[model samples]
Each structure stands twice: as structure tokens, then as C-alpha cells.
Target: DVAFLLLTFFILTTEFKQPDVEDIVTPSSISKSKLTEGDNTMTISVTKDGRYYFSPTNNPSQRVELLEKMGEKYNITFTEQEKTAFQNTQFVGVPVAQLKAFLQLPEDQRKKYKGSIPMDSANTQLVEWVQNNAKINREAKLAVKGDGGASYDKFKVLFEGLRDIEFYKFVLVTTEE
Candidate 1:
């Protein structure tokens, strides 16, 4: 009876982890401290090629609200169905101009999307996102997971943007060596 119960537990608990939207080989750190799983944590994934993706933890309602708030700020509109889809999405990497269409696509198709949110002078979308997200979720703490090979130049603008917005407290997500 015990053996049968153990087998059932193993079968129920085994699960496959999904692949990340972008590949990030985080730099190793001497300190092995783990980041606590805070309720209002937001993560920014940065790839070696300098792309960015954003995700917030565990709250579907907040996720949908973020989409709606961004739409209001950008003068864009999203249908109810699209907002529902965005709420279920694990992370977002596309630009606002393409977000409506991107959200409309099926999950499989969204995984195929390779675009990143713009971070340049002409389109500082990520900065805008961080600011709005902070306002909406006042306790949200940002965790930036940057690839080891990503350039400092790629990070400088984001740092400056955070500084300008007075968002100085952030975590650098890294691997422990």
C-alpha cells in the first residue's frame, strides 16, 4: 500500500519546466544568497544579444491591469479576449505597436516571436513599462537577469532610466559559483 502511494505521488508531482523566452546565462557571483520570493516581484530578462523581456509573479488580475494601463498610456486598445490572453502569458518581449497582434496570436505562435521591447531614444518602451508598473504595483521590486556576455552599454540606459525615476533599489539576478 505504501509503495503504491509513493508511486502515485511521484507521478502527480513530476512536471516539465518550460523553456525561457530568451536564453540568459547569468554571471556567477561569489555570494550565494537567494532572492526571496516576495509577493510583488517583477523580473526583467536580458539576453546576450541585448533583448529584454518582462514578467510579474503569480497574479493574473495585476497582469491584466498592466496591459490595460499600458494601453491607456500609449493610446492603444485591447479587446477583452486579448487582455485575457496577456494575463495568461508567462512573459512579454514584443513592442507595444505589435502587442495587440502578438496577444491575439496563439501561445505556440507567441513563443516563436523573437522581438524585444525597444530601449532606444526613439522608443524607450521598457522604461515606460517599469515606471507604469511601479506606480500600479507600488511594492513591486525589479529583478534583472542579464546574460553574462551582455554589454555594459546595454545596461547603462536601463540604469539611467531607473535613476531618473528614482527607482534605485533593484536586484541583479546571478548564479552562484
Candidate 2:
């Protein structure tokens, strides 16, 4: 039946929101301007504790390539199956060293994986992750979704990381009342 096929198509194509998606309360804003969505946006979610999670783009191939680049940089090799798992992940917060084990977990457990990419001066993995992803898609836009309770200092550090890579402009995800 055409109607059955149509419903199946929609279900297969829809990307379900991750149930354990980062728990962050974005500050409310009244701005009318909106950032364009789709594969062009690369979002970094910051929790109240200042933990940084790199959210992959909606494109699965792009996400896989992004993970590959990160793995190569950290001297960690990811198998084909692990790469596939990484692509399907909603967001990755673990350090490069732990990425392999993180990806190997079952889907439900992967969602429970708790980690954060290092964004400090000594680590700089955060900038590397963004840089590699940007290389994959030159048109990608950067955005930060910070917790409402997160301190300005945490945000300042994140901005500085982006600045080191010559990125000055970015969207701030906010909730509208």
C-alpha cells in the first residue's frame, strides 16, 4: 500500500531526539533571528560543570569521517563497526583515548556514556575536533549551547579555543519564552 510505504519512509528517515541528550538549561532569549539548521551546523554543548560535548552534524558520513580524523590525531584506530557506531551516535563527549571503548558499547549504554572532550590549553582536543569537522565541510557553522547555570569563565575558555583557530563568529543556542 502506498500509504503504508509513505509512513515507513517517514519513520525510517526521521532522526529521533536522543533520550539522554545532554541535560542543559539554555538561557532564555527574545531574539527573533534563528540559525539555519541542517548539516551546516556543528554544535558544542557545555554542561553546568563546564564539560564540553562535541555534537556531530546530522550527516552520518560526515560524522564517521569526523571520528576518523579525531582517531588519527590521537593515534587510535577505530574498526569499521566502531566507525559505524560513532556515526549513529547523537553526541560524543569522551576523550580520544576512550572513544573506542565508548563507541563499542550497546546503543542504550552508549547513551549513558559520560565524558567530555578536553578544552584546556594543554589538551586543545576541542579545537582539533572542530577544525577537522570544518575541513570535512567548509560551510559548517559553529554554535554553542551552554547551560544557563554555567559560569562566564567557562564560556570564555571555549571562545578562546575557537579563537585560536581563527573562528570569531558563532551562534548561541537559546530558548525563547
Candidate 3:
């Protein structure tokens, strides 16, 4: 009777949503430290292809979304023609300058952006823009979850970018099973 009652209670309280499956990540055998827990944690995932993912944790149990999801949400897709011209030889990700211009634009305005913003301008503008955005988004944790095959150097760049902007709480994401 008690088990049945508990089952009914759980069924009543449980919520369901589409789950976002993350890539399998094998943790390195380096340091064994106690895990920290708090409301202000950021999640970052790195794809095998060297793509970085910054998953916000504002809503618990919800599918993770990028802070830059705004760019996609607003239909700010970079075309192959543009990306070819925009990318450096590495092709790891968007150039820092381009990232800044994209970050600076208001959500609605981002979709309409056509031309690239110069490197120097993007540097100055992105610093301020990230500072303000991070302040506003402090509650949303910034994370980096990289693929097992991604280069350590690329992860270093991503980490430096977040730290340069004064974002501290980074949580490495991994698949549950």
C-alpha cells in the first residue's frame, strides 16, 4: 500500500520534457576534487569537431541551450559562403571579431546583420558587450562541454574567452550513462 501510494505521488509530481542528449565524455585521470554545488553554474560542452557549447542552466531539467542560442533563435545563420570568407585556417569556430559583432546586436537586429565588423572594433565592443551581458546573465551558468576528440588548445581558447570577460563558474558537462 505504501509503495503504491508513493508511486502515485511521484507520478503526480514528476514533469516530463524532451531531453537533450550530450556526447559521451570520458573524464581525465588527473585530480580528484569534491564537486561544488550552487545556483550559479555554467555548462560548456565541446564537440568532437572542436565546436564549443555553452549551455545555460536557468531552468532545471530543461534541454540545454546556448547563450548564443539567441543568434539561432533570431535566425542568424552564417552561410557557407560567408563562413568560408570569415573563418581563419583553423576553422575551429567563428573569429573573435565576428563573435563580438553578433553578441553586440540586439536579438532582433542580429538576424539582419550582413557585413562583418572589423577586428579592433569587435574587440573593444565585445569586451563591453560581454561584461554587460554576463552581468545580466550571471544567474545563467556558463559551461564548456567539449568532445573527447577536441584539441586541448581549443578548449584553452574557450576558457580564456570566458575568463577574459570575468565569467568564473564553469561546469564541464558529460553524458549521464
The models' CA-based lDDT, in order, is: 0.83, 0.85, 0.43
- Write the residue-wise lDDT of candidate 3 on 1-177 in tens digits: 999999999999986531322343645544455334334443444556554433233333221123234335445555443333222211112334355444444544543333321113234322233343355455555445566677787667665665776766656644444
Scored by TM-score, the top model is: 1
TM-score of each: 0.89, 0.87, 0.47
lDDT of 2 by residue, 24-143 (tens): 999999988887767778889898888889876778888888888888787888999998898788787888898889988998888877788888878888878888988898888888
Instruction: Tell me the TM-score of model 3.
Output: 0.47
Query: For model 3, where is the 10-residue window of minimal lDDT?
Result: 85-94
Better of 1 and 3 by lDDT: 1
Off by over 4 Å in 1: 3-7, 10-18
Whole-model lDDT for model 2 versus the true structure?
0.85
TM-score comparison, 1 vs 2, better candidate: 1
Enumerate residue pairs that collide in model 1: none
TM-score, cand. 1: 0.89
